[model samples]
Target: MPLLNNENKIPCYIQNQLIHDKDIKSIVFVNSHLPADETLLVKSITLVKRITTVSVVNNFTKELNLNSVDISHIFIFLDNINDIPSASSAIANQEVFSLNNPKYYFLFIKPTDNSRDEIKNILDQVWKCHELWKYVLVFCMETEWLRIVSYNPFKQLLVEFQSDCNNTTMFSNMLKNVNGYRIKTIFFYTLKSSKMENGKCRGNDCEVMETFFNYINATNEEVVLNVTEDLLYPVSQDYIKQDRADVMFNNMFLYIELYKYSAFAFAHSNVYAVVPRASTLTFLTNIIFMFTPIVWIGIGIIPLIYYHLLSIFDNYAIGKHHVRGILISKYVYALIFTCIFQSMIITTLTSPKYRKNIETLHDLFESNLSIYGVKDWMYMFHREVAIRYKPWNNTSITSALNNLTLDGAYIVGEYWLNLFLKNKTRIGGTYNDYYYKIKEAVGTGLLTYYTRRNSPYREIIYKITLLRNMAGLDKEFGYREINFTKALKSKSLTLIHLQSSFVFLSVGWILSTLVFSIEVITNIILQHIKTK
Candidate 1:
């Protein structure tokens, strides 16, 4: 028998420690990294578990034969399989266990703090053999453990762990004594003020730990807090409330500044909880009032003077022949009237102030306006109206109009407005007409165009009007009642014919107006010469 030498510091237990148990169910092989001898050791241990082991291969599988044994579990140990032959051969051996119907778990062991490039290379190999079941890669460094858990085909897997020592204690004790806390403590201690300077507690080293402990104690309720390396110092619950209050204050100030100038804001602040709606006409009128001084200076004064001068010149040349008379006749009257009419039309059509007053019928469909129209119209154009259209063939235009009147549908500019009003009384007439009621609602600003709240083209309208005024186009023309009537009839005919009626009507109106004016002028001149 060999004598045990106690003087040489060799004990029976120390000698036995070097020997690994062959019957061990789970084996943890410790080494600086996987070596050739270690691979043999792993293979021998796996053989006892009745699993075949194959060497890494470059091109072909080098199969190892083992007596058929019942394998229930398998754990693959690997570092980096840089050698293609060894890796391929090892995977080929793992395939045998699969045929043996063993439940397998592959464990890839790597030294921790791997760079992104190294991690990518490792993942490339792992993904290639992902068909194998139950795989886990563990990166072990003294400071941190990077674990890549399994992901199924359809779902993504995310692993979140708490960084706080107190919160993490419930899961794993290993994290509680991590090196992060030691590094943080060391950093705080090295601060310049961390050392006392006049018997006063100096630096941030005062009661940070105590305060943190208190915070942990306060959170008695179960709450999952996700931690990263950056979140080493946990925030206190009291500080979170202060942060929320600060955010609220900032938002309130921002909104208040936004609403400071307009009547909309004034009403919201002082008059009522919400602003009232107004008719298109009334809304535009108020907008004109808001910028009254500018209007008076820009177009009102100069246009009035110009119109008066033109009228004086036309009166002086009233007796001229047809061509000269046509050129000079009614020049002043036309100019003045044109100035006023054009001003109104331009303001109404292009101004941002007026846009809010009258929205397109489509706008009503899209808004919260309780309108009803045909389903086809709703499908095609109701998005612009902001209204809901209900399809009902049995519903007549008269009945629909009546319902709208009763419900006080403020604005009804739909395609069927004329058809709906054909049999209804005028606004002031009997039958409690819906159109009048709607008009009243609009006047009171109860139901108005949704677009009126914010003028989408306000700036563009202002710019265009400014341009028109600068170009001296601010003039109005009086409505020619007889000619307008004829024109209206011709326009109606064009609508009925749906052909080139507009061109025919335009030519006819111009010819008719010239002939009528010439006849009148010739008769007046003959009468004057006969009297003389």
Candidate 2:
């Protein structure tokens, strides 16, 4: 596509810089009617460079279809600065530019529109649509000496340079050399030693902040949050902003997911619940559960097999009548026991007859259990059932934590779920004895953090998050898998499986009875002799 004319050839240096990042597969050139000279330049660049490009002509006549276009880097050539506002508004509605990333933009302004006020005006017009002019480079040349400017993520720092070499080397150098930018992060405390949690932060927050500052190199500005849900929560975006915090531990733990922050996803969170252990069934129910009907029916078939065996043994064993009877009885007993044992083992191991707890979304809503969790956690994940139950107060929270409220299930993140188990065990001296997470997850929970917009440390934090997530954020962030793990085959072991133990116990009883008889007979004989 002939975009620019032959008279004005694009510098090779710019072409090399534009294709620097290997991540960018295709470049989008959005321009309107070009002059004869510029059109020839575009033709030469397009053919010689061999860089993949998507040409979208904006003649101000009709809407362009950018829906299919996967635009990463944008080359916008603007002749008139006044046309920028309308162009920005039009592009903002399109999916290609909806995110307002501010990066991936290289503005080629005409010399006439290159002024301090014009640049400020252009920024003002786009301000409502965009947050910060991050990674944006604007350039206009007057003969050989090049005039270029770069803006950082905050958009507060304006770096202008007049150099012969028009490359992005300055931008890279500026990013590293930039200093005096501090980040103040306010995080919610998971556990509080004092009754009142508001005054100062302690416990888990201290440990978390230590690891946080190590990666981010930021100071902690502690903020305590108390919600009606009575569950521990991270700080709100607005609250942290009001407190003048440069960064924050937002969208973490149980906070409602906000999509406003720049894309730096760190965690895969799900709405897991602390459900009552389903093994706590009644005696009658337990007895019924023990008989997990195997493929070959244990009860009915075993008796018939024993009968057949007894008949076979009677005929097969060649001995005296009493001896044959004893041998047949013993053989029948052993055969019947073995058949029952095999069936029960297979049945119980394959499918343990279980008392159904809340395992699915349908099961959860239908269940009578009062769900206790963060308000947003309940509302977002289980709105149907969440409406039925009220948020837990402090009193209810204490009781629920101690396994006092058996009917109530607490919804929590997999990370916090482990913490809950640890806390319970610390107090009660039991690990997973009282509560267990259900098989079905309510929702996926993300362990993402939202920094105060335009915070300098935001980029560093994002990079750290990327590395941590790639290495498994769940384990990297100290989430214990042992807490949530359940062994189905072994855990499903029930009372009826102990029948063999009872058989041995019965044999011990018979032996003890024989010993008692021998002792009594010996004592009686001794007494009779003494009397005589």
TM-score winner? 2
Least well predicted 10-residue stretch by lDDT in candidate 1: 265-274
- RMSD of every prediction: 28.2, 11.6
Error of model 1, residue 410, in angstroms: 88
lDDT of 2 at 72: 53
Tally clashes: model 1: 32
Clashes of each: 32, 15
- TM-score, each model? 0.19, 0.51
Q: Give the per-residue lDDT digits (tens) of candidate 2, residues 243-277.
A: 34544554464243444443355655566766665
lDDT value for candidate 1? 0.31
Model 2 TM-score is: 0.51
lDDT computed for candidate 2:
0.50
lDDT at position 425, candidate 2: 52
